[model samples]
Target chain A: MFTAPLVVAYPYKRTVGTLLSRFFQSLQEGRLEGTKGSDGRVYFPPAEFDPVTGRQLDEWVTLAETGTVVTWAWQSAPQPDQPLERPFAWALITLDGADVPLLHAVDAGDMARIRTGSRVKVRWADERSGGIRDIACFDLLEGAS
Target chain B: MARRDVAIVATAQRPNEVGSTLTSVELILPVINDVIAKVGIERQKIGFWCHGSCDYMSGQPFSFVAAVDAIGAWPPIVESHVEGDGALALYEAWVKIQTGECDVALVFSNGKTTSGPIDRILNLQADPYMVTPLWPGFDSLAALQARACLDAGVLSEADMAEVAARSYRDALNNPIAYAKENVTAEQLLARPYTTAPLRAHDCGVPVDGANAIILAAGDAARSLAERPAWIRGIDHRIDTQRLGARSMTESSSAAIAAAKAGVGDDRIDIAELHAPYTHQEILLRRAMNLGEGTHVNPSGGALVSNPAMAAGLARFAEAAESVFSGSADRVLAHCTSGPMLQQNLVCVMEGE
Candidate 1:
């Protein structure tokens, strides 16, 4: 097969907003929380305003980091500036405090064994100052006492 | 007046440069005036003003607000902006004319790809949590789709090269085109691949430029010209952004829009298609039900020059301009966004 040129796009700095700024800041302080919205959806990232009801959320609570991996896709070739240097799986992890799962990378070694309903724990990066990559990738909690 | 007979009266665009070292609202300011001057219409006569641009593209919010100053939008004109493509903005203005609310409207799109690596900026549109953090960038993600297309046998490397040859050949007639006097498709294939199954020819030249299209309705449209090209129909549709879940080869959104816009009955004399990539043009042509009788992308299509949000509207403008000049009686136009036309819009125009 012949080869051809391709064009691609990457990420640039985007604004997270005041409310999300606080939420992300708190997460960096070794804290975890979910904010309840009037629309009845508990958002882990903390919604500045309810998308459904158009109401603001001021309340929050600390939640457990343990969650089950609902589904995942293995990123065998990590792109530049990604959190992990090696192969990882992008997973929708349902943290204990939130009803819905949050998407994050998992340290799942291989795609074949990263099955549904895998229990995982947040492996916080040594440097955390609030951002999605703060968790880096979740580690398998299988043998942890 | 009923105001349903809105037509694109004038169109103007500047050359698309990779980084656009040019500055301010003035970058493409000269071209805007040139287009308006060709129509012999003053800018103040335009009743409605609208623009489509993305904040993420500029890496800042309300990036279009500054471009508005170029329009000299003072004393506060009725205006709006979309965070998406400029063609959608033109569609919004076109819809306003059809509704009898506004008689004339102006639309444009602008971006500076040189300010940052544009691929990184485009990732903001992806599934933020999972796909975005992985940072595949825009090309690799599209390459994944291109690879899928190859596996499905829906397209071949040479076919893309052929598309490039045909487009560049057509673009030779267009002075504003970016890909000018390029070599054969086989030679394009010989060039190294940027992503597997895709090449530089497969992608639109990254350009930073601004363009404006003006519209007129009913009597206002009539006064604007002796033979006005009227917008007969317009519609758009979007598919969910799950690349893994959706059909990889077909553009369902464009199909839905083509049906909604009543494309089946009209005789497409000339058609302009916005296919940022070569294979997508094939998908969109099938989706729009375009036939051999119809001239597809005589303006060299997006393969020649794409002003991001502006490319789609340029497709519409090109279709209308062809008819306006008495080259064709009826025409079809298609605009696309996302990988493989994840979102699509169709507009049919006819000359009186």
Candidate 2:
């Protein structure tokens, strides 16, 4: 006797628009810039408006790519379209010129080696197609030594 | 300036299911019309209209827009929608009423859990940049909080089972509820864990359904309800999305909302709470400051049937039902959002 198979489904798609779309467009062009919020704070991935004071963020500036990982969480299984396809570390990297921690994927697969103070570098995707996914993945800065 | 009052004059809800074989308009029309007909209020008289829903749930955007057509909104009666619960829509309408903007308003919502992997769909709500990439689905996140609470001595696994036992048993009396039963804390604990420290029963079932509530102010409200559940106060607030920044065991926003709404000193006869997770119910109970004497979840609460967008509003609707039935007078209603009780809304209802 033969049995019918059961099927299961889940969505792995996301839509990008508005402020985030503009922010990613800049990232795709190799220009990492931030807008100054009403609080006089330069927030990266420019908010539509200052979340605190509700003022428009119009001023822009480019930021250095180097940063230190503040805290890290290891993804045993990465989600679809994420920069890292296998088990890897996602860190909160505060770029040298930025005031807040920026989220990005670290190419390090072994989480036990990744720590709060571990140093990493961005490996910007060679062919930028105008999206946040353009950054692809970052690698351990072994050559930075 | 005196604080004006508003009450839930009429409420209606559909049964809970994992998936509904209905479109948004098909899902909402009957429930919306049912509430409107119950109160006999003309749709044109309604001042402001707002609803709550999430596109992430159905793998589509602006799903709530079609649900509006059931109201025949071609004339464009004032309206808006939040990516949240219909309870928040109720909160928005109440705020407008306090502003003396409109005399009557309608709030509603509907959600289908079976449209996709409901657990994974909730991941979109997490920190997309970091945490969500890890795929720590809702069950895992709740288990994380459950771990924190248990280790911190806030609640034990046994305590969670006890909550499940009570919620499921109570649901038996509720005809519209999805998961009803014959079970106890001991029996619940014996089941294997879905996530360590969290059993299947510990979480609210993902139910698909629709709900709507009618709100009238002052004289117009009195006409719809013999005992217009006057909304003495309604307030809501949100905290930073960083789950690690705040204690998961407490609902700070809900506490602030309760303080703003003046939850104390009144004889709150009944309380309807919306805590999708059992542990959240514990946190919300503390946040709302509802005394032990107050009856909570008389409609069996979310543990029995959690229909996402409609679930929260259904909570307030349940409380209003108690008021309409003359089973209780002053009532406290609560709605929650985000992981644990990160975001909260509270409303106080009173009879004439």
Candidate 3:
């Protein structure tokens, strides 16, 4: 067998745009922000326009760090570059006030602890950057089981 | 203006396999030659050529440009390409015929999924800022969808295992299929989960392959094949890109596309659905309203051999072949892209 290093890279930069700019900016401050749609639904990861109406949304809502797991799949063995190096649950979490859920990894210590509707809270990263990784991952809330 | 009738006259596909050392041109040339030979058509006489493939799949930019060599574009033939599955390219060819610009078109697609980490490569399709940065692989995302379907009571682990069991049993008849066996749901459930709630059999086996199809309009179609699979209706629709925002248990886009494609207007004798996961096959059956009478995935579908970029178009070829063989009068062929059946294309065909 022959072997060689094959690296696929996109070296260019991209603008995060209006809604995401604010969302990421908030992440740097250890806070979460969402966009309020014309239908009064708050969307986490803030969409620039309402999904149903296609209307521009600029209203921002401060979101809680805690949320409930809408759905989850246990990753028995995490792959390279994934959020967690060890076994974890990849979950869709609906923040306390948001109608839509955001996908992220949950460090629940073991598969037995994670389940649908389980409460979780963000575990902030030590170094804050204007990115989703600012909140490293969600952790199971104490005494929620 | 009344649209002209178009039909798939000829089709060819390479066997789905892993670690194919052949180049894209090497892999595509034989299929292209075979399809054109079946239709008895000259290379220069072909009105238009369209191709579907992703550069990221081969880890080479403008990878599809190399495939033009397979068709010998030196005579300056009309050509185009899509950075997706070949079914979308077939769609463009169908539209071209409707526009009265081209009477005959050739559509082809190929991919080497075994070249790299396919699961990680597919993650690039997710949202760059929010999702891709997390590097959530396709299998994990599919597992989440399966979990949601389980929670909603739309499907159970037993149901998914049954889909796998049936597909494996059916694939025994398919020469090109990679996975073929006579297994039971109980046997599959006894196995361990690769990703929670999803066994290895629940997912499609990734392979490297290519497929080509020849589409002709009106008189050209009638003269080419004894019984052509005429396109009755074709439509494509997509749901939200946000995986968390959409309903995981149902495929709204598939339902919409099926209705627009006139799937419910007639009794579908066969359905070749491109569902990569076992639960997804069940979900799509519900979305398209395909009943128990409809023969689903007779060629074993993607659950047996799923080659990225080419698998979707293979469904079209498989369904049309059923018509050509006089096994079915009306058939429904479906293709999907993105995560959790987020985007769907439904093409209804009939032998007339």
Highest DockQ, which number?
A: 3
TM-score of each: 0.73, 0.75, 0.99
Q: Where is model 2 more than 4 Å wrong at Cα?
A: A1-145, B74-76
Give a tens-digit lDDT track for model 2, residues B23-133: 788888899899889988668888888888887775666777777787787666899898988888888888788899898999988888766667777777886643565
| DockQ sort, best first | 3, 1, 2
lDDT of 1 by residue, B1-352 (tens): 5536678877777776665656547764776677678678766777788787776666545667877777786766888887777788888888777776678887776656555666666777786644576565655555555555665788887877888888988999897787776578878888876644567788777677677777887788788766777888889888766444456677788888988887888668888888888877777777788898988888888888776767887787788778778999998888777654678989888888
DockQ result, candidate 3: 0.80
Residue pairs that clash (backbone atoms under 3 angstroms), model 2: B6-B231
Please give the C-alpha DockQ score of model 2: 0.08
lDDT of each: 0.73, 0.76, 0.92
Positional deviation of residue A24's Cα in model 3 after best superposition, in angstroms: 0.7
DockQ of model 1, rounded to 2 decimals:
0.10
Every model's DockQ: 0.10, 0.08, 0.80
Tell me how candidate 2 scores on lDDT. 0.76
Q: Model 2, B174: alpha-carbon shift in Å?
A: 0.7
Q: What tens-digit string does per-residue lDDT give for candidate 3 at B1-352?
A: 7989999999999988998878899989999999999999788878999998989988889988988889887868899999999999999999999999989999999978888888899988988888998998888899999999999999999999999999999999999998899999999999999989788999999999999999999999999999999999999999999887899889999999999999999899999999999999999999999998999999999999989889999999999999999999999999999888988999999999
> Chain B TM-score for each model?
0.93, 0.96, 0.99
